[model samples]
Target chain A: MGEFDLIARYFTRPPRPGGPTLLGVGDDCALVQPSPGHALAISSDMLVEGRHFLSTVAPDRLGHKALAVNLSDLAACGATPLAFTLALALPRADPQWLEPFSRGLLALADAHGCELIGGDTTQGPLNLCITVFGEVPLQQGRSLALLRSGARVGDDLYVSGHLGDARLALEVFRGQLSVPAAVFDAARARMETPTPRVALGQALRGVATAAADISDGLVGDLGHILRRSGVGACIEAEAALSVIAARDALDAEQALGFVLAGGDDYELVFTAPPDARAAVQAASAHSQTPVTRIGRIEADAGWRLVDAQGRALQRQDQAFDHFK
Target chain B: MGEFDLIARYFTRPPRPGGPTLLGVGDDCALVQPSPGHALAISSDMLVEGRHFLSTVAPDRLGHKALAVNLSDLAACGATPLAFTLALALPRADPQWLEPFSRGLLALADAHGCELIGGDTTQGPLNLCITVFGEVPLQQGRSLALLRSGARVGDDLYVSGHLGDARLALEVFRGQLSVPAAVFDAARARMETPTPRVALGQALRGVATAAADISDGLVGDLGHILRRSGVGACIEAEAALSVIAARDALDAEQALGFVLAGGDDYELVFTAPPDARAAVQAASAHSQTPVTRIGRIEADAGWRLVDAQGRALQRQDQAFDHFK
Candidate 1:
C-alpha cells in the first residue's frame, strides 16, 4: 500500500464520546476542546535511529518509549494526559514492523487515556516524533504546572522510585554489562517499559512547588529547578540508603553516583514547602509510591552534598547529553 | 556549547507581544486566543534530510520550506496565518548552522505575522517538523473551511499561478537541463522560494467550497479532491495552453505534461459552484493572482482530458511520491 493508504488504515480516527478526546484523528485538523476548568500542557519529543534508539531495539519497545518519554514530561508538570500526534519517517513500508509498532503505541496510549489523534507518515530514515497534550485544572493557579522555579530555601527535596536501571539497560544492550537472568530481566523491563509517575505528579499538584522528571539524571534535572528558582540544594548522601542497600553487586558509592548522575529514571524529583511536609507525606500516600526525601533547598547558589556529620562530599555531574 | 545551551541562546523564546500573537512562547504550553468569531485552522508537515531536500540545500531554505509548506495548507483552508511551533532534531550542536536556520524561520514568521511559539530541540539525525495554526471566521451554516469533499459535478475547476517551474528547477539542479539565464532564474526562484497563496485562500473562503494545495503535481493533487468529493473531472486541454505558450524550446505537449505531473508548485487548486463564479472572479481581481478556468467536475469517477477538437488526450500521471 502507499503511504497515504497505510495512514488511513492504521491511524485515521475520531475521538470517542465520553472520553478525554474531544476530537480524535482522521481529519485535515483535529478539533480539540480543552477540558473545562483546566489549562493545557504540551510537549514534543523526537527519537531518531542511531541517536535515540538502536535499530536492533524491538519495535514494540521503541513505540512504548516514544510515548513514555512524553508522558514523563506531563508527570513533571502534574497534568492529566490527554492526547498525542505521531509523525513517522521510515525507510520503507514494512507491514511486519508497522503492525507491532502500532500495537505497542496503541497499548500504552489506551492504558494512559491518551488518544492517538492526528499524524503524518512518510518515507525517510527512521525518525519518530510524538507531540503530546495534557490538561491541568486552572482553579489551583500554578498548582497545575509545577514550575522548576518554585523551590524555596530550606524546602525538602524528594525523588520517587529507584534510578540507573535505564542507563544500565543500555549497558546491557551494548554488551558492557553482564548480570543474573532476573536482574537482566528487571533492567530490560526498566529500559523498555518506563512507568511514568503520572499519579505522583497529580498528587503533588498542590504539595510540590518545584518539580521535574529525572530524564537527565537527578543532579542535572534538579539543577534546572535550582537555577530557575535561584536557590541551592543540600542533598543528604545517605538519603537513598535503602536503594543502595538493595544492590547485590554495586556498592553504595557507585549506586549513589548513578542515582545522582544516571539518566532516564522517568521518576519525579520535586521540592515541597518546608511547612507542608505533612501534605507531602499525604500526597505520596495517595500515589502509593515511595517518596524519598533526598535533599533540602538552601539559600546559597551552589548545590552541595553532605554526609551525616555535615561534611561536604565532592561529586561529578554526568547527566545525559544527546549531542555528547 | 551544549545542545541545550544552543537552543536557549537561539530557539528558546516566546514571540514578542504584538500583531496576531495572543500568547507567545516560553512556557510548558503556548497560549493562543484567536480573534473572536474565528475558527482555528491547523496543519503540520515534517521534512527529513535526503527525502525532502538535498544535503547541500541551504539551512535557511530548509527552515523556510518547512514552515511554508504548512502555511500553504492553512492557505488552502482559507485561514489567516497566526502561529507555528518547530520541532527540530539535529546531529550535533553546531552554532553556525542554527543561527541562519532560526533567522530564516523568524523572517518568514515575522512577515506573515505568525508568532514562533513553544517547541523542542534535540540531538538526532536531521529531522525538522513544523506544526502551524491559523484562524478563519466561524459562521453557522456558512462554510469557511475549504474542505476536499465539496466538489460537485458541473462545478468549475481552477488553479492559481503557473506550474512546472519547480520540477524543472529540480531537473536543472540535477544537471539534466540547460537553459537561458532568465528561465533558469525563474525556475530556481520557484524552487527556492515558494509563495503560499494565503491571500487567495482568505479570499476564497466565501467563494469556493472544495480546495487543496498543489504539492504532488496538478493531476495527482486534483485526484485527492476528486476522491474526497466523489466526483470526476473533464479538463479542457486548451485552458492550460497559456502555461505552454510561456515556455521556450518546448512544444505544447511537453509543457502540458510538466504542468500535469510536476510537483512542489504550492499553488491552490480549487472548485467553485457555477453560481459563485462571479465571486471567484472578484477574488482573483482583489488578489491580483491569476485564476484560470481549467475544467468542470463530472459525475463519473475518473478525470479525463479533452483537446480543443474535443478529442481525448493521453497523459501519464507522474506525480512525485516518496514511496511508490
Candidate 2:
C-alpha cells in the first residue's frame, strides 16, 4: 500500500462521539479540546530499530512498547492519557507488520481511553515517534502535575513496581547471562510489555513530592530528581537489591548492578514527606502497584549507595548515555 | 556530550514569562496551558535522511524545513502557533551539526513565537519528528480552524505563494534538469525554505470555506480537499502554468509536471465562495501573501485540467506515492 493508504488502513478511525478530538485524521491538523481547569502535559518519544528495539522483536510488541514508553512519561507527571499522534517511517509497507502493530497499539490505547487522534506516515527507515497529550488537573493556583523539582531534603524516596527484569532480559538476549526458561520468559515479558504506572502516578500526585519514571536506570533517573530539587540521596543497596524481581536468578553483584544502573525499567522513583507515608502506601495499594522505600532525600548534592551496615559502597551519577 | 548535557546545551531555555508552558524541557513531560475556549490544533511531521530531505542539505536548512513542514499544517488549519516538541534521533552528538541545526530551528520558532517546550533526543539513524501545537479560535460554538471538508460547489480555489521551484530544484539536484546559476540558486532556496503562510491562514479564518497545505504536490494534496469536501474542481491550465516561479527555467511540459505533481511546495490550497473574493483578496493583501485564483469547486466529482479554450486536457489524480 501507499503512504496514505497505509495510514488509512492501520491508523485512521472515526473520532469517538463527544470526544476531545473535534477534528481528527484527514485534516492538515487535528483539533483536540483541552480540559478546562487542567494543563496539557505533553511528551514525545521516538523508537528506532536496533537502537530502541531488536530486529527480532514482534511488531505487536514493538507497537506496545512504543506507546508504553511515552505513557510512562505521562505517568511520571501524573497526567491522564488523552490522545497521541504517531509519526511512523517504514522501510516498506508490510501488512503482516501493520496489522499486528495497529492491533496491539489500539488495544492499549482503548484500555487507557486514550484516542489515536492523527499523525503522519511515510516510507523511510523504521522509526516510530509518538507525541502523547495528557490532562494534568490544576488546583486553585497551582499545577498538581508531579515534577522532579518538588523533592525536599528529608523526604522519603520510594520506587514503584518491580525492577531489573527488563535489563535482565536484555542481558539474556545479549547472551551475557543465562537463566531458567521461566525466568527468561518473565524477563522478556517485562522488557517487551512494560506496564506504565499511570494510576499510581495520579494517586501519588498530592502524596509524592517529586516523581520521575525510571527508564535510564535508578541512579541516573533519580539523579535528575536530585539535581532539579537540589537535594541528594542515599539508597540502601539491600533495599534496592531486594526489589529486583529476578534476583533469585542472579548473583548479588548482578542484582545490585541491574537494580541500580540498568536502564529500561519503566517504574516510578518518587519522593514523599515522611508524614505522608500512609498516603503513599494507600496510593500504592489503590493503584495495585507495589512500592518499596529505598532511600531518603538529603541536604547534600550527590547519590550514595550504602550497604546494610551503612558503609558507602559506590557513588554513581551514570546512566546509559547513547553517546558515551 | 551525553543526552542530557546535549539537550541542556542546545535545546533547553527558560520558559517565556506568561507563556503557555508551565513546565518545559527538563521534565519527563512538559505542561502547557491551553487557551480557554479554543481547540488545540496538533500536527506531526517526520523527516528521515535521504527521504524527506537530502543528505547534502546544510544542517541549518534541514532544521528550518523540519519545523516549517509542521507549521505548514498549522497554517492550513488557520491555527495560531503556540509551541512544539521535537523528537530527534541522531547518529551521534556532533556539535558541528547540532549548533547550526538548533540555531536555525530556534530562530524560526522565535519568529513564530512558538516555544520549544520538550522533546526527546536519542542515538539512532538521523530522524527528526516534530509535533507542533497551535490554537484555533472558537466562535459561537464552532471552531474557526479551516477544514478540508468545508468547501462547497461554486467556490473559487486559490493557491498561496509560489510553486514548481522546489521541484525544479530537485530535478537539478538529480541531474535530470539543468538551469542557469541564478535560476538554480533561486529554486534551491525555494526548495530549502519555502515560507509557511501562517499569517494568511489565520487571516482567512472565516473567509475561506476550505484549506489544505500542499506538501505532496498540488494534485495529491488538493485531492485530499476534494475527497473530504465531496466536491470536484476545474483548473485552468494557463492559470496553474502561470504560477510556476521557475517557469522561465523550463519548457511548458516540464513546468506543468513540476507545478501539478511536484511535492514539498509548503504552500496553501484554499477555497472560498466567489462572492467572498473581496474578503479573500483583503486577507491576502493584509498578510502580504500573493494568491492566485486558479480553479473553482464544481458540482461534478473529479478534478479536470482544461486549456484556455475550456478543452479538457489531462484528468490526473497522481501524486508521489513512496510505496507505489
Candidate 3:
C-alpha cells in the first residue's frame, strides 16, 4: 500500500468528543484549541532503530516507548497531555509491523487522552519521531513550572517509583548479566514500556520546586537540575541503592552503579523545600505513585554522593550519551 | 561534542522577545501560548536522506527545505506560522555541516516569526523531522479555513507561481535532461528553495473556497482536493502548459508530463467561486504572489485535461510515491 493508504488504515481515527482537538487527521494541518488560561507545553523525541532499541523488540513496545519518552518530558514540566504527532520512517510497510505499532500507540494515547494529530510517513530507515503538546495553568502565581532552575538550597530531593530495573533489563538483553525469571520479566517490562508519571507530575504542580525525568540516570539528570538551579546536591548512596529493584540480585558496587547512572527509568526526580515535605507526601499519595527521599539540594557547587555516615563515596559510571 | 552540546551550539537560542513561545530550549519541554481567540494548526514532515534529497545537496538548503515543507502545510490551511520543533538524527557531529544548516534553518524561521521551541538530537543515519504550529481565527463565520472539502461544483481553479521547475531540476540532476545554464540555475533554485505561499494563503483565507499545497505535482495533489471534496475537475492543458517554466525546452509530451505529475512545487492549488474573481485577483496582488487560473471544478468524479481545442489529452505519469 501507499503511504497515505497505510496511514488511513492504521493510524487515522475519528476525533474524540470534548477536548482541545478540533480537527484530527486527514487534513493539511490538525486544529486544536488550547485550554483557556493555560500555556501549551511542547516536546519532541526521536528514536532510531539500532541505537535506541534492540532488533528483537516488539513493534507494539517500540510504539509505546516512542510516545512515552516525549510524554515523560511533559511530565517533567507538570503539564496535562493533549495530543501528539508521529513522524515515522520505515524501510518497508509490513502489515504485521504497522498493525501492532498503531495499536500500541493509540492505546497509550487513549489512556492519556492524547490524540494523534498529524504526521508524515515515509519510506526509509526505521525512525520514529513524536512531538507531544500539553497544557499547564498560566496563572499558577509563583512560577509553579517545576523548572530545572527552581531548586533552592536545603530542598529535599525525591524520586517517584523505583529505578535501575530498566538498565538491569538492558544488561540481560546484552547477555552481560543473568537474573531470576521473575526479576528479568519485571525489568523487561520497565525497559520496554515505561509508565510516564503524568498524574504525579500534575499533582506536584505547585509542590515540587524543581523536577526532571530520569532518562539518562538519576545522577546525570539531577545534575541538570543542579546546574540550572546554580546549586549542588548530596545524594545518599544507601538511600539510592535501597530503591533499585535488583539491589539483591547484584553486588553492592554494581547495584550502586546502576542506581546512580543507569538510564531509561522515566520516573520523576523532583525537589521540594523541607517546609513542604508534608505537601510533597500528600501529592505522592494523591497520585498513588510512591516517592523516596534520596537526596538534598545543597548550596555548594557540584553533585556529591555520600554514605549513611555522611562520608563521600567514589563512583565510576557515566550517563548514556548518544554521541559518546 | 555530546548530543546536548551539539544542540546547544547549533540549534538553541535565547527565546525571541515576543511571540507565542513562553519557554524555549534547555528544558524538558517548551511552552507556548496560543493567540486568545485562535485555534492551533499543527503539521509534521520528515526528510530522509537518499529518499528525500541527494547527499550532494547543501546542508544549509536541506535545513531550509526541511522546515519549509512543514510551513507549506500550514500555508495550505490559511494559518499563520507560530513556532516549530525539530527532531534531528545525524550520522556524526560535524561543525562544518551544522553551522550552515542552522543558519539556513534559523533564517527561514526568523522570516516567518517561527521560533525553535524544543527538540531532540541523536546519532544515527541522517533524518530531519519538523513539527510546526500555527494559528487561525476561530470565528471566521463561514469556515474560512480553506479546507480541501469546501470546493463547490462550479469554481475557478487557481495555482500560485510556476510549476514543473523542481521536477525539471530533478531530471537535470538525474542526467535525463539538460537545459541552458541560466535555465538550469533558475530550476535549481526552485527545486532547492521553493517559496511557500504563506502570504497568499492567508490572503485567500476568506476569498478562496478550498485550497491545497501542490507538493506531489499538480494533478496528484489536486486529486486530493477532488477526493476530499467529492468532486472532479477539468484542466485546460494549454493554460497548464503556459505556466511551466521549461515549456519551450522540451517536447509537448514531456512538458505535459512534468506539469501534470512533477512534484515539489510548494505552490498552492485552490478553488474559488467565479463571482469572487475580483477578490481572488485582489488577494494575489496584495500578497504579491503571481497566480494562474488553469481550470474549473466539476460535479462529476475524476480529473481530466483538455487541449486548447477542447480535445482530451492522454498521458501516463503518476505522482512521486515514497513506497512506489
Query: Whose TM-score is greatest here?
Result: 2
Candidate RMSDs in order:
2.9, 1.0, 1.4
Residue B135: error of model 3 in Å? 0.7
Off by over 4 Å in 3: A140-144, B140-143
For candidate 1, what's the RMSD?
2.9
Order the candidates by lDDT, highest first. Answer: 2, 3, 1
The candidate maximizing lDDT is: 2
Tell me how each candidate scores on DockQ against the true complex: 0.44, 0.88, 0.86
lDDT of 1 by residue, A30-53 (tens): 444455556556677777787667
- Candidate 3 lDDT over B51-153, as tens digits, reads 7788999988988898898899999999999999999999999999999999999999999999998888888999999999998988842224668888889
Q: What does candidate 3's lDDT look like per residue over A195-291, in tens digits?
A: 9999999999989999999999988899889899999999999899888887888898888888888899999999999999999889999989999
| Candidate 2 per-residue C-alpha lDDT over A162-215 given as tens digits, one digit per residue, 9 for 90 to 100 | 888999999999999999999999999999989999999999988999999999
Error of 2 at B320 (Å): 1.6
> Can you tell me the CAPRI class of model 1?
acceptable
Local error of candidate 1 at A220, Å? 1.9
- Which regions of candidate 2 fall more than 4 Å away from where they truly are? A315-317, B315-317
